[model samples]
Target: MHAERLYPILLLLGSNIFMTFAWYGHLKYKSSPLMIAIAVSWGIALFEYCLQVPANRLGSAVYSAPQLKGMQEVITLLVFAGFSAWYLGEPLKWNHWAGFGLIVVAAWLIFLD
Candidate 1:
């Protein structure tokens, strides 16, 4: 990938990580009130969109909308994998990796010319 493409992809990847945490990290904090968790999630999600939107816009010059969406999905899944292992203290087994690989293959198909 070109340097420009790499930056946007990195931005998207980072944004997805924030978004995944915002959306699902609350599961680990079950002791917190539902409303409180929702509020906190929304706060974090705002930051996610801040980066996500720019990443999409920058990537748009080099990729189509569907390609950008596919890239976002792939990055989201990758971020969720790391978040699961770290924040959720969950282990990723071979099957999980295989499933992710399949999803990446789908992303490639979506982005292919």
Candidate 2:
């Protein structure tokens, strides 16, 4: 693929990393106060939005709105799968893999000419 498109994909991947951590990283710290979790998550999410906004703006040059969203969803799931297993020690069942496979197919369809 062209570098123009690749940049947005890379940016999206980075943003998703921050996003996954923000949303789920605190689960391990259940004893932490709710306010602390919320505050830290919000701080992390600030970085997510920083990259996400630029990713969408740059991606818009090469992709439609639906395509951009599809890319985001696909990246999110992939990132979450790794985060869930490694960070949370929660591996997905076969059914979850099957569901995510279908989503991958959907993203493929969305990107098709």
Candidate 3:
């Protein structure tokens, strides 16, 4: 694939990394105040949007809205899985894989012409 198509995927990957951290990194600090967690998550989410907005805009040129959404959902799960295991030390189980596999199939269906 050309750079134009590839760029969005890269941006999405980067965005998902930040997105995962923003949404769930707070879990590691449960003893902290909820207000502080929300504030910190908001800060991190700002960076996520920085990449996400551009990714969607650039990807729109090459992919449909549903395709972009599908891609983002799949990317989000993949990033979350890694972040969950590595950062939180919580490994995924068979059920998670089964569900995620179905999502991959759904994405494949979305991509069909």
Please estimate how well model 3 matches the true structure, expressed as its whole-model Cα lDDT: 0.95
- For candidate 1, give the lDDT of residue 97: 93
**Candidate 1 or 2, higher TM-score?**
2
lDDT of all predictions: 0.89, 0.96, 0.95
Q: Per-prediction RMSD in angstroms? A: 1.4, 0.8, 0.6
1-113 per-residue lDDT for model 2 (tens digits): 99889999999999999999999999999999999999999999999999999999999999999999999999999999999999999999999999999998998899888
Structural RMSD, model 1: 1.4
Q: Tens digits of per-residue lDDT for model 3 on 1-113?
A: 99889999999999999989989999999999999999999999999999999999999999999999999989998999999999999989999989999998998899999
Residue 44 CA displacement from its true place in model 1, Å:
0.2
What would the TM-score be for candidate 1 when compared with the true structure?
0.91
Q: Identify the superior model by TM-score, candidate 1 or candidate 3.
A: 3
Off by over 4 Å in 1: none
Q: Which numbered prediction scores highest in TM-score against the true structure?
A: 3
